[model samples]
Target: MDIYALQQDIIRYSKEIGIDKIGFTTADPFSELKARLVRQQELGYNSGFEEPDLDKRTDATLLLPGATSIISIALAYPSKLEDAPKGKKGERRGLFCRSSWGLDYHRVLKDRLTKLEAYILEIVPNATVQSMVDTGALSDRAVAERAGIGWSGKNCAIITPEFGSYVYLGEMITNIPFIPDTPMEDQCGTCTKCLDACPTDALVGPGQIDAKRCISFLTQTKDFIPMEFRKKIGNRIYGCDSCQTSCPVNKGHNHQIHKEMEPDAEIAKAELIPMLQLSNREFKAKFGHVSGAWRGKNPLQRNAIIALAHFKEEAAIPTLVELVKKDTRPVIRGTAAWALGEIGNVDMLSVLYEALEKEEEQEVRNEIEYAIDVLKNIE
Candidate 1:
């Protein structure tokens, strides 16, 4: 079998099946990434969401025995929402980042990878293959960068020339000695826009992220957002887009080529107040399809409370009051109390005082008391 011809055939097949970009590279151990992960762990910068096994994460051979090459594929997602709804004075909305806008890219990319895997196995009957999307052990960006899908941008995304940084990446490791493509040179020379735009200084340096401080990571957490970053989070419910939106390379790169990857404007930019009241079952029906729903509705509900506070919407007081007084989850009740304080409604003091009287949870009690103090000072 002609290896180069087979590689070209795979690339053509990838495009026909909706893969925007495809590149091949040797399954060499990612030694540099191993060092970076160690440094990240040492500095307490890790998000705790990543696969914890460092050796498995950096070595493709561990995942698939006799792995000789890796194929990286990228699917471009729509960056801009054409008919996005506008929120009024009383009604505010929260944004899920551009990446989470579509039918979860994981499923989208997995379909393509499954098809590619079957095609390869059919031709090379003895070829060993394994595939993964974001949840996989290997760093998707690192794989894509090495495979020539794009250069690793300053914001830590693979910035493809054709698709910019607005692309979803996935990879397949196989024992097929497909010749490797050349890696792209760094194109983010002297650019500080992504670093400067990071809301929480999560971009510690070019291509280095302190994930703990990142709004995207913070939003996914089940507990309270740190006080310092709450204001920075603003109306973002799931992920933050400050870095990606500010990049000059990504300015005009909205790709709507894949129909399934397009976002529902109403769901993507959802109303903040309505989010707080969603039952777990109701939440799943509405948002379960999107990637942002992975953490479930509690985190998003807490963020909605924070967003309502950010807006200082007097209209949300009743809803926030409801959450503070009767919500079963301590995080929800406490966050709502804090939002009530942030809203600075002197009148809400009575409602908080009433909740404090009945509240038993230590954290929730503290939050209610703190809110009462914040409101009392306004008098």
Candidate 2:
């Protein structure tokens, strides 16, 4: 079998099967990535979401025995929401990041990888293969960068000239010895747009991120957003896009070629008030297919409350009061109290003190007291 010919065939098949880009690389250990990760750990920047074992994350062989080659695939998602509903007073909408605008990318990429896997296995009857998307120990960006799919950008995204940095990445490891593609040269060229645009200053340096301060990571956490970032998070319910949107290369690269990637404007930019009222079932029915929902509704709901505060939506004050007075989750109650402080005026001070007297959770009490103080200061 001509592995070279087979590689070309696989690339063509990938395009036919909906993969936007494909590249191959040797399945050697990612030494540079390991070093970077170690540095990230030392700097206390690791987001606990990653694979705990660093060894398995950087070595392809550790994941798939006898792996000789790796395949990296990119699927571009839409950047702009068509007919997006505008947020107005009494009708504020919280925005999910562009990456979560469609159905969860993990499923989308898995389907593509499965199709490619079957094609390769048919060609090489005894080929060993393993594939993974975001949840895998292997870093998809590291695999894609090494595979020549794109250069790692200063924004910590794999930026393909064709798709900018708005691409979803997934990878496969196989025993087949396909020729590796040459890695792309860095093209960022002294641009600091992404760095300057980061609201949280999470981009500690070019190609480096302090995940703890990253809005994308913070939005998914189940805790109350730190007071400092609550204002910065603004109307973002799931992720932040300041860095990506500010990139000059990404200005005109909205790819909606994949039908599954089309954003439903209503859900992607959902109303803050309605979102606050959604029961678990309602949230799942509306957002379960999207990747942003993977963290469940608590974080999204909490963010929605904060988003209401950001907009100073006087309309959501009633809902915020309800959450503070009756929500079972202390995080929700506390966040709502904080939002009340942000949005409610002097007139609402008495209502907050009333809730504060009955609040059982010490944390919730603190938030109510804080809200009272903020309202008083406003008077």
Candidate 3:
């Protein structure tokens, strides 16, 4: 097959599979990305993907032997109203980044990539094929940029004019040789909205993320949130989208307009009290199949407690009490104590005192004492 003809076929097949944007590139990332990844690791920004063994990742090469090019695809996950909250007065529109409102991207992309791989195999019977979503060492966004799909935004996300930065990236590494696509030039052009909109200053510079200060990381993390960012977390129970939301490209792509993905009622309008009440089994049942399932209930529950505390809603006191008294995870209990302190009520002193005595961990004990002090002062 001639290179030009083959490229056209691949694009047709990709669109047939429901992908919104397609781009191609040879398997070499520029030196700048490598340096940034190293710096990010040094500053503890890579903890999310730093596990000892990541099966889908490969660094020696983005492709197998005889590999000549890559086929990168972008899929759109439009926001849907079903994901929005209901009957909640004084609540800000529950903000879920448009990208995560639907079915899990891992499953969606994996299924689409599998189809692409099978199609390629049918044409080149002995062709080697490996697919990746966000799982691998391959830089999905970098590859997308090289493929001419879009320019990398200041938020460190791929920005497509048609879809903005609200696209999921996936790629296929192949042994078949093909012509590579020209890379796109940066179009972000002096725009600092994403940088200024960041609640945690995760975007230290253009295209640079500390991840350590990222709200997405904070909400997605398993450990207790660092005290510095707890108050700024707002009502975000899962992933955060402040930077993207503030981007001009992403302004009109909310549930009121786009309709590809639907949000869960519970998640869209997430009630701090109900989230606190979710049992382990219920938590799993509700979020297990979704991307939010990874951090399980602890982080989300913790974020919810903190959000309620920030809201200063007296209604949340009973829920916070249950968490402090009986939640098995000390991380949750400690955060519960912290939230109680922020909410500040006279009755909470007794609860904080009880937790302080029973609290075995120094961190939780300290938080409990702080809560006791705050409550006493409020009284």
Candidate 4:
């Protein structure tokens, strides 16, 4: 069968099916990806679910057994001018990162890729198709880079010229061999903007990330966020986009805006006082469909308390004290106690003092006592 013509046909069909960029590469990720994964695993730097078995996914013999070609795809989620938040300073304002601002990429991409797979079968008559997004064991970024979709930036994310790093990636593995595209060169020369802009300094070096220190991982992680990274999380209730926001490559690229991802208008700019009041049901209704849904509202709610504490918003004291009494998670309680201290509200002092008496955890008690000290000083 003619492979070059098939490649052209696939790329053309991908565009028609809503994918912004498409290219082909051999299933092999070469040595770079292997070394990176090895180093990450060696250092025990993985987060978000148990660390996956890398060998099962990366070894071609294990994945596809006889895989010959990889069809890498990118779907763009552009921002719209009208959808931008009204002001810069609010708890729940502005757009989310371009990648997750609309219908989940996993939902949109699998539908289109299924169509593409059907087209491929028509051409070859006998071919195998394996589809996956970022959720898979395969490295989507490495595959995209090898396919000439883009080069990996210092952030270790694929950076395309047309779409920057805002696009979600998917891939189709097939037995049919096609002429592979040449890899792209690293274009982030002397640019440390993403590294500099990170609040927690998660980007430790060029193209290297300690996921433990990353705010995105911390916010979504099931475990307790480290005590040090607490206040630096700012007002971001979900994922942090500070690094991407600072990248020059992402400055002006406008894709189709997904407005559904924006937070509700009434409370989008509401102060921390109200955010701490959201019931579990209320939180689910507001943010359930978003990426942050799985973590529920407790972390974000706790983060709001921390934000208020950082600002010394004494107005949030009543709500914060209420949370300290009712909240069950020790990590959340510890942070709330710290926030109450930061606000230094005398009204909360008795509550904090009482909470300290009942508190069993040493860490939580320490924070409550600290709050009591601040309240005593203010009194």
Candidate 5:
């Protein structure tokens, strides 16, 4: 069997099946990435969500024995939300980053990868293949960069010339000895826009991020958002796009080819108030299809409360008061108290005092006292 010809056939098949970009690379260990991961761990910069074992993360052979090549694929997603709803005073809306705008990209990319895997097996029946999306042990960006799908950008995104950084990445490791594609040259020279635009200064330098300080990471944590970043999170309910949106290379690169990726303006930018009251069943029914909902409702609701504080929407004061007085979760109750304080309407001071009397959690009581202090200072 001519492996080169088989590679060409796979490329053609990928395009036909809606893969925006495809490339091949040798399945050697990612030595540089291993070092970086070590440093990131040492500095406590990693988001705790990554696969824990460093050896498993960098060695493709460990994932698939005798792995000789890797197939990397990129699918461009819609950057622009067409006909998006506007947030108003009485009806404040929170934003989900562009990545969670539509049906989960994991599902979309997995579908494409499954098709590619089947085609490869048809050509090379004995091929050993393993595939992964974001949740996988292998670093998708590292695989894509090595496979020539795109160059690693200063913002830590795989920025394709065709799709910029607004692309979903996935990879398949196989024993096929396909000719590897040449890696792309880094095009991000002297651009500090992404670093400057990071609200939490999460991007410590070009191509490096301290995930602990990243607003995107912070938004997904299931605790009270650190007070320092509550204001910085703005109205974002999940993830953050400040770095990607500010990249000049990403200018005018909105791709809307995949119908599955088309944003439902209502769900993507839903009103913040309604989210505060969503039951587990209601949250799942509405947002479970989106990738951001993977962490469940606590993080989203926590961020929503912070968003309400960011907007300081007095119209939401009653709802915030209700949450503080009656919500079961202390994080939600505490966050609501903080939001109420941020709104700083002296009229709500009585409400805060009333909740303070009944609140049992020390943390929630402290939040209530803080809210009372903020309201008192306003008077």
Candidate 6:
């Protein structure tokens, strides 16, 4: 069997199936990544969403027995949203980061991988293959880097010359010994834009992130956002793109090739007040298709409350007051009280007093008391 000829055939078929970039590498244990993961764990920089076992994350052989080579694939997503709705005083909008603007990328990338697996099986009938996207044990960025998909950028994204850092990456491990491609040279070269632009200084150093402080991570957490980072979160409801957007390599690199990746003007940049009142079913119906909805409606609603405070959207006062008074979730009720304080108007004091009287949870009551103080100071 001519492995070289078969690799060529796979590449051609990949293009036909909508894969933007593909590369191959040996399935050697990722020694460097294992060390870094250890260091990140010691420093508490990991997001806790990653696979916990270091051996499983860095050793390709553990995931698939007899694994000889890995194939990495990338799909470019759009950066700019065309015809995005304008945010005005009363109708303020919060943004889900560009990566979440389209259909959930995990599903999109997995579909591509399944097709590739089927094609490979047809050619090499007995090939043993295993595949995964972001949630998988192997880091997609590490696999992409080793397979020559792109250089690891300072923002920790895989930066491809063709698609910039706006690409979604996935990988497949197989027994076929395909010749590896050369990794890309570091093109970032002394650019501190991404590091400087981080809202919480989450990028502690180039290519190293403290996920705990990252706005992208903070927005996804189910609990209360730390007070220090709450105002810095701005209007981001899902993920934060400040680091990627600040990079020089990503300039003018918006690609809208995939139809499923196109942004729905209203869904991508949704109204802040409306989000505060969405029922679980309503949230699912509107945003379940997007990647950011993985954490469900609570975190988004919490961020929406913070965003309203960021803009100090006075029109949202009534909705926020209602949330503080009646929202079932303590986090929501507390965050709403905090937002009301940030949006300080004399009239809101009456609502705060009413909530303070009825609020049973100590956390919610504390937030209501804080709001009362903020409003009283305004008078």
Residues 16-111, model 2: lDDT tens digits: 999999999999999989999999999999999999889999999999999999999999999998988898888989999999988899999999
List pairs with backbone clashes in candidate 4: 78-255
lDDT of each: 0.92, 0.92, 0.75, 0.74, 0.92, 0.92
Candidate 4 has its poorest 10 consecutive residues by lDDT at: 87-96
**Model 4, runs deviating above 4 Å:** 48-51, 79-96, 257-275, 376-379
Tens-digit lDDT string for candidate 1 (78-181): 99999899998887998999999879989999999999999999989989999999999999999999999999999988999998899999999999999999
Where does model 3 exceed 4 Å of error? 50-63, 80-83, 86-96, 254-260
TM-score of 1: 0.98
Cα RMSDs of all predictions? 0.9, 0.8, 2.8, 2.9, 0.9, 1.0
Superposed by TM-score, candidate 5 places the C-alpha of residue 110 at a distance from the truth, in angstroms, of 0.5
lDDT of 4: 0.74
lDDT (Cα, 0-100) at 150 in candidate 4: 94
- Ten residues in a row with the worst lDDT in model 5? 221-230
In TM-score terms, candidate 5 sits at 0.98
TM-score of 2: 0.99
Report the number of clashing residue pairs per model: 0, 0, 1, 1, 0, 0
Score residue 209 of candidate 3 by CA lDDT: 87
Model 3 lDDT tens row, 99-164: 556567788888889998888888778888778888666778877888888999999999888878
Least lDDT summed over 10 consecutive residues: which range in candidate 3? 51-60
Runs in model 1 with CA error above 4 Å? none
lDDT of 5: 0.92
How well does each candidate superpose onto the true structure, as a TM-score?
0.98, 0.99, 0.91, 0.88, 0.98, 0.98
Q: Which RMSD does model 5 reach against the true structure?
A: 0.9
Candidate 1, overall lDDT?
0.92
How close to the true structure is residue 86 of candidate 1, measured as C-alpha lDDT? Answer: 96
